[model samples]
Target: MSSTPVRPATSRPGAARAAGWVAPLCWVAVLLDGFDLVVVGTVIPTLTQPEEFALTGTGATAVITIGLVGMMVGALTIGTLTDLVGRRKALIGAVAAFSLLTLLCAFAPNALVFGILRFLAGLGLGGCLPTAIAMVNEFTRSGRSGRATTTIMTGYHVGAVATAALAIVVIPSLGWRWMFVIGAAPALVLVPLMLARLPESASYLLAAGRRAEAEDVARRHGLELESPPDRAAARSGGAGAGGAAATVRSLFTDGHARNTLAIGVTSFMGLLLVYGLNNWLPTIMREAGYELGRSLAFLLVLNVGAVVGLLVAGAFADRVGSRLAGMIWFASGAVFLALLSVRLPTAGLYLMCFLTGCFVFSAQVLVYAFTSANNPPHVRATALGWSAGAGRIGAIVGPVITGALVTAGIAFPWGFYVFAVVGALGAVALSVTRAVRPAG
Candidate 1:
């Protein structure tokens, strides 16, 4: 039995308090997702040591690609499932599943075993991200959804930074396996908190006709039920369909077809830049004459920029619209990425890395913010899932392409060129989506 009374939403303070609780829970979930997401990259340097995984560049890329393949499948499938089931259930299930699998990865006997475990862990990893993003957007105030989404996503960079810091201290002495051990720790801590405290999406509850529960949840959390005016049409043609196929079909049938395609292409390009650089940046720098420690430090600096970028981009997006913000941010990211092709002094390199991180990581996130802002509640989860799923294709390709280049010993200036091009393409895709809106 519980003793906490439901606070009346009579004042803005009450609403802010309720939001405080909900937002942090969502933040922790995404933080764990981010931590696990970057763990592979953090450990790749150690994994290549002769005493460690002894993986070739191609083999390492295969592991990353395989994991992303699983993530793509999970993002497409489980994202729709989040819409059908409740967001609460999907989020908890994903965190728990990934945590357990990642713990098992510590004991993998060979490269084959490690790659398989990473792939399995990735299913949960991919599933949790879009769900977390959707949850934050749904719970926050309408106009603030973009900021809420980006704010909650800061947890991802925090998690990535934490992983990188730990790697700096732990990987040298504790071995790369310790990183997996640490990555799995969030599950033990976060799962119980989520199950006991996290509230279900009021929008989902209302759509499913659980009026009493939805009302109670809304009251307790100081959130209004997001029953869009177009509920009838959304119910008939979009998310209300019990089948994933029907839901997916609805994305293209409505005026959403063009927007959907644009989001997909944009996500593909955005994620390619994100994953490609994050996964290969350290190694690329190391190959280009930087020491291993400094290379790892660059990853940390990059994500620090990501944290700043999320706050800046989110605030700007709320004022100017995500479409315009994304265009500007992606363009900025392109210029910084292209600048990396020139080898500068250590201070200059660090500045560029930080600036690149500021724009590059949050560029894709603004695309997500745009998707959430544009879609109605009924199809929001599915739309975000598909967009992220499309991005996962870029995720799959990014590492593989970078890995191939690394194997061929041509990953330096060429990798930066490819990433810069991808960033430009993302900006272009977002520009095209400005003319299309979802059909009601």
Candidate 2:
């Protein structure tokens, strides 16, 4: 039924061509996840208009928090499932499921229905980040894990930035609902491409004892199989990854328990900053007396900084190690976040937002890079999943806390103070952990 010939290991160009697509495909999936991060924030201004959803700040928080709860569950479950089932299937299913649910969000009858759709859509969206991050890391050359993880994550902020820009044009003309429609449209193409072309991780295949399949995948992609020295342990750990419960247990039993707790706390604070700011910054700025369009621009500026931060942090982490980089970045984020409380001039505010964006988002991502560096292949997804899942709880709390502040009319400067403290906590968490070689 197919005319494609199997390329041999010597086919360098074919291998390069084959190996390169993985990052782009996974990037777009992450971009969609990025879109989710900002699309709600983009629309909140419009939704609060009396003619629109008439959403109070409290209602907005409820919808956003419920969605995050779904992501928490999805991250915990899908991250483990990806390890057990195979990255390819789990990713495809996640993209398709999220796309379909996002499309349904366009027609939600009221805030209640809209919130429900968001929760359902979040299940798939939550899985996308950990899955994409883990997939890209496995394919990367070693020592480049920081850059690889950060590079792929640019898609996330790219999506957020693009959504902010699109909202400016689309929301004024088409209405708030069109954002969801546009967001889901990419998945139609992304899913089919992933289905037809995306290769399974060779690591997963080998872990499952499908050596022939693993070797073929490795050979075609111009990758070497695990050498005998390290292969035994990778395989042994992977073998136990067969069941989700057992795989989770492996995380605690190895020297990983401390790293797990540390990563969990760091991820919690990291995501709390990420979701808190991205989802609520526009509202926060608006309450501080910025007009609607200017408030939206703050969202764009923040994520543009995120893109720059990812590029810089990735390279920086590679040089200094992820843990050390994370400490500096989180501490820096706290400084900038705390500085936002000062009533700066317009240009100064924009510059601070840009700088804040740079460190704040990447600070969380560095935690992910650290996680990838510390865990072995078999339990990597589970570790990433649980880490991200734990972060989702923070994501929920960030929005709810800010929304309550907004409701009380005290969100602006006080919100920044709370966020600054969270950033400090993250730095503290990472400071406690000494680096370890990845588990077998």
Candidate 3:
């Protein structure tokens, strides 16, 4: 019997440009998604005023939680679908769905109706990040994945920063509804570009037995084609498994259970800190004795720190291990978060806010780096999707907790301290997980 010829795992040079463009494009899409997701939080303070929207505290929290619930469902359902359909298609569909729903939010008659629209919008928003990350992961070369993913994620922060700034100017004159209107506009621009320029994942096509299409994509991007390998071998090479069942099974069988749980937990805590702060920072600052205008300015400053952190993390993680770098970052974040509870002088508070921003947000991206590195190709999408899906649960919880704290008359410093504790817990979880490296 003749053996099938084996292809060497050599680097393909032609994919560099394609890979470069793919990361930035995916980044922009996710950035817009992040902007819309957080804009509601930035506007909540205005919405809650009796003279403005007049929403009660608990009612407002309910609205935020409803959107999160929708996002959780969206992440799980759309994540699975990304495996069945292609990432590009799923992403385009998700963006369009959310875009229209956001427009609906602009016209919502009451708080309940607005909440429902936001939840539905959350469904589409939930799918965008994981799908975009998966696309970027597939396009990047080995050893460069962390940098590529983080670089792309910087767009997310940039979007948030832009939204906060825009909200300051626009919300004052145009009203909160205009924010949704503006949010919806990006989908119109992005959808067509994605359809025209976004290529399907080469690995997904190969797994689905569409070698011709896969090869065409690879050739267009300057990759060479090899015969598709068996399922197990393809998975081992990091060609992601396409089906839901197969992807889940891969996580448990190959010394991955521990790693999976670790990623889930770390992601949980990271997101808890992220959503808790992002959702309540402005409100919390207002309660902490800052004026409304200064509170919104703090939001911009926080995101500016986020952008700086994301830019630096990849280089540091590449030098050290991602796990180690993530642990240190989370630890620093915890420290800064706790310190925010104390009333620093004005300049000191701003400095601390910048420092906190630098580490807190990127710590979550490091979780993505860990997920991408731990799983092989076939199960990579599934692993990332599940991680993100789990993290969304924490995201849902963070805002609710902050809302409750505010309702209870807890000082903003105390609320910040609570967030700091979550960050500390995350640092601990990630530290333990780092000890056991998965076989790639």
Candidate 4:
């Protein structure tokens, strides 16, 4: 099919305005992802209480792990599907799957059923981020992908902040299931809007040997299509084992292996810090003797810092490169996380929590930004998929460890220390990768 039609690209301002829908639509999808993922953490306290879900520490951790397992699978599998089915279809399918699954979560009869629903939801959750990143990168003007990634990622923090705020009000009154109900509501609004407004990736079209479609897309977005569509490569790079296998092989060929391995390691460390904190920050804060409200509010404050970090880090990444910005953010994150070990006044604690979120969350995103910026255009989608999938090891482990710590009653001081160490490791990982890029 020809690319989604737009006004002729002759007028610069007109073409720019016409293409404005890309970032915001992707932002909405990312926002929903942030909301869905953060909701589990926001309601963890309620779920574990004696009179409610009565979930044990181990069971709670298992729930999180199960979900992450699905996420890992989704990232690895559906990411390949995007290359085959087109970005819009894959993205919309992912959002639809997760949204519907999230709705079912409210009807889950017990923890096991709820966990299953969450697991399925994780499939959608896991697939959305990288696909969104790839699409956003493709949609932006040349040399601006890093900035676009960071800006679109701000939707994630905004969703986190909004959902956490909602939790403060809803958990006590309507109970936790209602939170899932609200989380599912986005599909109704977003899917139609996405279908109406979201354009398929021109890069995907070009790569797939759809020159006419690619050229149409390029014209619509004021982009130039380079090289006729590579149909042979596209067919050979089809999805499933045949395609994914070759793409994986390509990564290891032509000196890409070193960089690939380095990013994998960095992604693992960075995600450990991200998923760990996202899953346990409230619980950790609460166990530190903060009031429950304050603990939940810390989630809000932390995500507020995340939004700020996105803005600051995005600009810096655009100028100095995502690798250096990631290193700086990770180092700063380590220091702030370590400081959480000390009990402080309310103001001091809030400030630290905000700053920790600012650095820790953005640090991982910068890793993603770096991955998006550095890889070969042909293999970029696959590389991102694999990097994110590899990182899910940390996503799976982080919550489990934090859960065990919380169960052991050491989540406050010790948890922060552990996170501090992970943050440092992430920084080092990113630093190591910087020296291992493709030899020109």
Residue 314 displacement (Å), model 1: 0.4
lDDT of 1 by residue, 13-70 (tens): 7655755666788788788767866778777767788887898977877776788888
Q: Which parts of model 4 have CA positions greater than 4 angstroms off?
A: 1-11, 44-53, 229-236, 282-294, 407-412, 434-440
Residues 4-114 of candidate 3 have per-residue lDDT tens digits of 111113365555455456676688778876686578876787789876668887777788788888877787778767766778888889889998998999898788899
Q: Whole-model lDDT, candidate 3? A: 0.76
Question: Model 1: what TM-score?
Answer: 0.89
lDDT of 4: 0.79
Q: How do the candidates rank by lDDT, highest first? A: 2, 1, 4, 3
TM-score of each: 0.89, 0.91, 0.88, 0.89
Model 2 C-alpha lDDT per residue in residues 353-405, reported as the tens digit of each score: 99999999999999999997778777778889999999998988887788789
Better of 2 and 4 by lDDT: 2
Off by over 4 Å in 2: 1-11, 44-56, 228-242, 283-294
The true-versus-predicted C-alpha distance at residue 272 of model 3, in Å, is 0.9
lDDT of 4 by residue, 151-234 (tens): 889998888778888988998999998999999998898899889878877767765656588777767766655445334445
Q: Which stretches of candidate 3 lie over 4 Å from their true place?
A: 1-19, 45-54, 224-228, 233-242, 282-294, 409-413, 434-440
Using lDDT as the measure, the top candidate is 2
Best TM-score among the predictions, by candidate number: 2
Prediction 2 TM-score vs. true: 0.91
Clashes of each: 0, 0, 6, 0
Candidate 1, which segments miss by more than 4 Å at Cα? 1-16, 45-54, 226-241, 286-294, 407-410, 435-440
lDDT (CA) per prediction: 0.80, 0.83, 0.76, 0.79
